[model samples]
Target chain A: MKSFLQPEQWTMAAASHWLLVTTVLLSVMACSSVPAPVAELAAAEQAILTAEQARVNTYAASELAQARQKLQDARAAVVQKDMLQASRLAQQSKLDAELALARAGAAEALAVNDEMKKSTEILQQEMLRNQTGVKP
Target chain B: MNYLKRSAPTAVAAAMSLMLLGACASKPATPEGVINARQQLNKLQASADLAVLAPVAIRQADAAVQEAEKPTKDQALSDHLVFIADRKVNIAWAQAQDKHAQDQRKLLTDARDAARLDSRTREADLARSDASVARNDAERARDEAVAARTAAEQERMAAEQARSGAEQDRLAAEQARNAAALSQQEAESANAKAAALQAQIAALNAKTTERGLVVTLGDVLFDTAQSNLKASSSSHLANLAAFLKSYPERGVIIEGHSDSVGDEDYNFGLSQRRADSVQGYLLGQGIAASRITTAGKGESLPVAGNDNASGRQQNRRGEVIITDAVTASN
Candidate 1:
């Protein structure tokens, strides 16, 4: 019984070693041919530019700054030869910039709507006064 | 399911391997952050306004949510996916909110325009009312001025009439004053004449008889059987002429008388000549000839009998009679 359990334990250990080694070898081979996330980095840079053109910093300052930081981190990941992480970071940076732009647009739209409502209210009050004063 | 269906060499080996791989080999539970992100995405997708407004962003968020939901061995990769998914969902919702506000702007703009138009119309009406009020005030002022002009004209006419009436009254008063002065002068002259006539009658020693006032001239005034008056007797006859002239309303008759003892025709002639002399003297004294009448009487009537010579002498005389009497002031 001891001998049977011993052989089974040895087989499990060897199989685990083989699986680890194959995973490492495949990862190394994949890394040697993988390119930098050039398109994603460009897309993120373009999104940041669009947000700046939209004046996102004035309304969503923290969000725009986080997007810039993410872009820088993405570039660093590319130099470290971590293509998958670099791609994911570039996508996150673009989304961050997009988020900043979206939040700024919402804030500006809300402010404009508020001003329009206030103007309408003032005109309505003025008209009310005119009617009441004359007719009363 | 396929691995479970395959026959194993021993029950113990299959059972131990299943137990050892149970915690890790089973499908990984989704992370709490990823679940939250998916829930948020689901909520946004349920909204028709959000889905229509931000379709592209919603689709991107869906993709990120799916990626985060993927079973992975690397926790860091899972966490990054969850982070991106969370941001993507928020961004989509924010974009949808902005689009919604933009869409609502149309209604707000329309309302504001309507209010502005109402205000402008009311202002135009107010301007018209103000113009009407101004016109009324102008008309009132014009009417007031016309009334004032008419009143002033009436006052001017009244003043002119009063001035003319005052001038007429002044002229009448002046005429009345002139008439009163003339009447007073005539009355004074009448009074002076009456006083002088009274004085002349006293100097002549006129007697009031039954017939009239008579001034008697004695026989001594003329010479015996002569028609001429004596020079000393001329003084007495002069008073008679002045009295007659002063009382021009009175007339006098001069009568010469003689005694019965004288020759009848001779006495008559002598008496008649004596009266003629007295008349001639009065004519020279400025008395009118029509005011004097003279006659001669030869003893036709006598106051004494002819038995005594003194009686005959007293009976021969000349007399003057005044016919009328006039009171002084009347």
Candidate 2:
């Protein structure tokens, strides 16, 4: 039983070693051929930073969180030596951060518009009272 | 077994060298992006509005900061996490501010509605008060009109009373004036009657005495020593009868007288017969018999002495006396 097992084990070990070598060679080749997603990562980081300055974290919290998660996925892809996936994730993160900033501005403007509408209602009531000669 | 021992020592040496190289490459200093993200997170958490209105957002921002602070070999990935964390913190602060402004607008709207209701209630109260005043004024005017009518009625009654009194006074004055005029007319008529009676007595050659009116017939009115009246002297007796007829309220007295030439007894008889004759003649001429009385006077009541013819002539005569209603009683 030992003599039979030793041959099979040696064959298994040789196969594992060849697979390991092939995986390492493929990883090296992929790293050498693909460019780093440095520009896309920088754009995603700059967009999220601009959203923070514009108060998007509070007004568009869900969108800002989604942008942050996409940027993290992009960094993980870079570490895995998948430059195409990393660049795609970084671009998506930049667009998501820009959307979060626009949503924050839109929400703030909507709140302002609601307040202005209430003021106009009060002004109209005062004018009616004056026209009718009713004391206030 | 010999190949495994040799390979194991080689793997151990490689592992140790690899660990040393990793130690040299690792960054111990905190990244500037991570520090800025932490500061932003702390500012959001400290806000009073973020704790209540934006609690969920603040918690999300805190989680992002923690993720950003995690150690990583990739510098680009660490910077990206820090940027997202800062944006999350700003989102919490903006939500809190917007909510506060909305509450203020609601408060102003409520105040405006309350003021409008109060103004309408005041206007209704003023209208009710004015209506009450108008009703009172109308009632006063009606009362005044009633009072004026009562006063006019009283004045009319007073005027009626005054007119009745004046009419009574005028009737009394008219009655008194009529009585005075009647008395004056009666007095004047009585005076005229008295004057006409005096003229009739004068035409008979009568003299008024204390007793009545007296008329004398001379001796020539009769024949000498005769009892009969002559026709030429009958006119005097007729005129006397007419005066007696006109004055029916009078009575007459007859007297006879003679001269002394005759015997005493015979002369008395002749004087009596002569007086009777004159009275009988007056009665035949329409004088009431009850209005005459007769008497004779012989030598005892002669007007002259028998010595002279003129004296004897005057002594032979007949006389008549008429008595008024007042003198006849005596």
**Each predicted complex: what DockQ?**
0.56, 0.05
What is the TM-score of each candidate's chain B when compared with the real chain B?
Answer: 0.55, 0.48
Candidate 1 chain A has its poorest 10 consecutive residues by lDDT at A1-10
Which candidate achieves the best DockQ against the true structure? 1
Tens digit of per-residue lDDT, candidate 2, span B261-319: 87988887788888899889988988777888887877678877779999888888887
lDDT of 2 at B107: 59
Model 2 stretches with alpha carbons more than 4 Å out: A1-136, B1-187, B261-269, B297-299, B326-330
TM-score of 2: 0.38
What lDDT score goes with residue B270 in model 2?
A: 80
CAPRI quality of model 2 = incorrect
Worst 10 residues of 2 chain B by lDDT: B114-123
Q: Candidate 1, which segments miss by more than 4 Å at Cα?
A: A1-34, A76-83, A134-136, B1-24, B152-330
| Model 1 lDDT tens row, B180-215 | 777777777777766776677789988888878878
Candidate 1 Cα deviation (angstroms), residue B271: 13
Best by lDDT: 1
